[model samples]
Target: MALNFYGLDLIVASNIGTIKHVKYNSNPNKKPDIKQLQRIKELEKGQGITCMTWADAEQTKFIVGRKDRTVQTFNLITDEFSDTKSVDFGEGKLQSVSVFGESIFGAVESGVIKIWKSNTSDEHLLNTGGPIEKMKHCSYNSSIIATGGKENDLKLWDLEKRTTTFHAKNVPHDWLQLRVPIWVSDICFLPENNGNVVAVCSRYGAVRLYDARAQRRPVCNVDFKDQAGSCISLGHYDKHVIVGTGRGLLNLVDLRKKGKLSKSYKGAVGAITDVMSQKDANVVVSTSLDRHLRIHNAESKEIILKQYLTSKLTCFLLRTVDSFIKQEDGEITIKQEIDDSEIKDEDEPDQEYDEMFDNMEIIREGISSKIEKNIFLEDKTKDVTVSKKKMKSEAKKRKGNDTINDASISEDLIDSPKKAKLDKEEEKVNDEDIDQSIIKLLRSTEKLKRKLLSKNKKKKAKSLFYK
Candidate 1:
């Protein structure tokens, strides 16, 4: 799901074989009315939608990756879906999809990444060592993207050069000389830099920061021992990074402090799958495997909005009303400009004239309703109804007609005895034919039974001879 420029929330949720567009009531105090929560529209989906990314800056069009190994485009303005502008990845399941300006990036479970320079048939493929869990395009430099998963640690790739940019070297060995296994779950490019710095979270509960231009080894590493870090998102102004852990903890890491954990937000009961920061960064929204979507205050670390949806939600986008309004440059001005031609005079009779017309409209509507009611009454009176006496007369007439019909039937019955005898003879002939067919079937069954008995006797004789 993606947010539109109008600050209206749009999310695609699963419904049978299709996806539904759900718009939430953004008002915090007012509960969403159930009647208004009707499905906006349903788009046919092959398998389930795995990932989605905006296709345009206005967020009118978005590309969705499905488990069926295909990508589709959905247009919000027209409420239409186009699978024509798609790239198929054979049998691999899509792990993530990203839209970076004119290029589309998709990573799949087969360790292959597909890139489309434009929304056309032309595409390019890049192979990683193993399945990719997450791939994020660099916002600072559109030509760079970061991918990490499974056996593949964090690696930055330059789209223009089509080569690996930063290959993170492992941090040697532990004090006991045990080699750490590489399992990067998610990666994000730092926006503050010129696509040189990147951060990654791993299944080993480690968050590492690597600078592509500077070093092969991670510049900073922090491990939260309790649970694994599944996803990471940058905080406001890139001051801190919000890590969603497998234990449902939101850890705020300060970048200036060498990736130190500053604060923690709690309240989720299951593993956090995804987390997104609002434009202001004051509020962060997260989805968990426990079927809950939560919004938390960044400063106080308090839960602001916690809603439990019945289905397992993987992704969601939030848009606020302030994004639509232009920011004020300076303080409000007391003086304003007005045109004389557009001004209205207080002595004019426009208000009185409008009031008179409104009164006449109300009177006419009332008279039309009264006339309709009278016509309905007249129609009801015109309906014909029979009395009890007329009803009894009709019943008697029907009884007499039935007796006359019965007499006719008796006369016809008496006139056809010869035909009845002939029919009986024909029935007898049919019975004989049925008996003959049954006898033939019985004979065939007896012959089959005899052949089986002969075979069994022969087998017994052969067994005795062998003994």
Candidate 2:
């Protein structure tokens, strides 16, 4: 869940417990190596590490939020640890943490958002809301913070003013009580001069672009055919916004023009739990409930690297530096792969299996009926033609026979009503005989018909074309 930048020699907080040190190389020309640089020592006791924020450039000092409702600081240079400094905010758990300059901000489970300065004093600058679901620092302006949660409310707060700058309300409320809150999944400010623009995604499969400077509503919105599960995680690199959904889909939104879907990558087989962008912005990494860590090239949508992990990653942060570190001997050790085998198996019964079987049965029955109808129609046509030819030949034969026989015999044969009735009955019998033959063939060769039908299906499939 943590992103390590080799260039900056920094490792941000990830959800895999406490990973205080990273092994890396110093020189690009030499073989890769590992260095045991320790950042936090107290994390060895299995204290829950929920979120991390770097306070300095060297990444020597940082703050981490733990499950015990405490925030602790660690200094890498001195290899020292500080005990939790409790901030009184009722009883809700802290879900997210961020740093803007010397001030620190945390979003709690009770929907309350709080901020404190770097001096580590008992005083806090701002404490707002009951508990915040998600929070992020504004990219362009460090003074602004965006917060959202179960209430479907998005608030933009200005640290200087100590108040909300803009409050956007009435977000979709469906699925709010779901496993993952269906409110605002994630909100991110675009990079560079596009500070006024922000993208917000909801759990109801909606991605909307809003202009903070505009007086009206959002400029554009997309629903992805209403299939994007829930927008749980989001990242921004230049003009593109990458969104991770509950269904484990990584969607790329192009904001350069009006908002448009550029591409979508299969993030993982399970729900996407977290996503991070590398310092280069050309690549993105995501973690899923499927216990997979996937890295993708932003432009090509090609997976550059995929590693299986044992645990479901809950959160991830990328250090804003290259992934290479230098050593005295000019050796480099690439970032160590995270082992995610800690995730337990939680497969549930598939609910769609019965419906799928029913659909298949219906299709099979339709095909069988169509085949029977076609065979019956073809036999009836052939029998009618054969009967007409036979009748014409018998009439010609009778005429020739009569011309050679005596005139009295011909008159007697013509006057015989019983014979005429018998001829009519014979025609009816022939019709019934043809129908019985067709029925017998259909019943006796059912298995053969099935085989032929299968073969015809294969042939038709081969002839079908798909774009």
Candidate 3:
């Protein structure tokens, strides 16, 4: 259900089966030793890893929501499993579970949300409402929960009050018999703010920021050209807000400057299943249905690292903490054995590293040709400088021609035949000049094409010589 990466260790949540201990940076394709594979096989049985969270380095707790509407919690430190606790909610499966302080919240399929106090018996905080699609805790306080549901509504709930604090509704209307409406996909609270403003995304390709304290209206909405998929994840660092949509698109929006999308990264071939931001905010890791985990520089939107996986990663968590040891003799000792099976082989070397560096010279000649191709494909209307220069040149030519025509007409007005002959000659010359201008433009384009071809041929020759 979830994989939590802490330092160099990977804590996997196997809902009902045993938890897997894997190296954080290991490769999935690498073969494990006999004993390690056997251990992994044991953990892969039954309902599989459900959901796991680290209570500490020595302890972890995971909940397995079984098909029979039962939940079981396993303590990894004690190796003791709790008795199966049957969920009182009618015959629906548990969709998601979250732990906050001393409480656990479960979103069930029966359109009901249940809460249980960890210290007390497995009882519900409020057995109200239908199934919630997604739920998240406000970063500022764990007591507040944000829920989105099938009804296309976002509700803010206060645990202490045990009631709804604020609700935003999406209503449908019919104009000319067209039913148009909005549906909430995901919601997140901005960092450092006490749930004062929340960013909500919808399936209709719009992301909106709402102020809970203000009237029931959105502060700003951003519309994208593509239809966003179901999942929407948000990460905030300083004034930058990183948003990931289900359509495998990543956007960085600056809160300080409204209505501006600063950077975007496009790499995921399929829907993005989850996104986890590093504590430093410079790097963000995302998993998609394409079975790849990609790391991107949040500021530059460039891919730094990409790891291929065997399975689609559903959820992931990252945390930074102190190293798990004290410096006694200027050395750090780890109690657990290092699992080297996870480190994958680097992509096959096409050539020796030094040889490849030397061979890169072949691409240098081709770069200019590629650049020209890109420029030609780009929107010409956006070339402000070129358009301005063309306009100025045309204006000066028009002024000179007007003065010439005026002087010729004034001097030849007395003689009708001579004036008529002069007029005809001038018209022919004017037409020739117009034709030459058109021909000159065409020839310039042809010259660029020939230059591009020459550069490409040289690059090809260089490539073959290197081979």
Best by TM-score: 1
User: How much is the lDDT of residue 347 in candidate 3?
Assistant: 30
Q: Which regions in candidate 1 have their CA more than 4 angstroms from the true location? A: 1-27, 32-46, 84-87, 117-119, 279-281, 319-467
lDDT (tens digit, per residue) of candidate 1 on 1-467: 33433223535333112333433334566432211121223334455667777776545567777667667776654666754445566346788888765777788877788878654667888987777888888868888888888887778888888899787888879989998888888777777689898888888898888887889888888888967988888875465778999899998887665668888899998888788777544677788878676778878888876765545556654433222221237643232223334433342213434566788733455556446655754553333122334444655675577557657676676578885586568656655665565556556556655666686677778896755
Ten-residue stretch with the least lDDT total in model 3: 31-40
Candidate 2: residue 287 Cα off by (Å): 1.8
Query: Scored by CA lDDT, what does every candidate get?
Result: 0.67, 0.61, 0.58
Clashing pairs in 1: none
Scanning candidate 1 in windows of ten residues, the lowest lDDT window is: 32-41
Which prediction has more favorable TM-score, 1 or 3?
Answer: 1
Please give the distance, in angstroms, between residue 28's alpha carbon in candidate 2 and its true position after superposition: 15
- Which scores higher on lDDT, 2 or 3? 2
TM-scores of the candidates are 0.62, 0.57, 0.57
lDDT of 3 by residue, 234-259 (tens): 65465455566776887776555355
Clashes of each: 0, 34, 12
The order of the candidates by TM-score, greatest first, is: 1, 3, 2
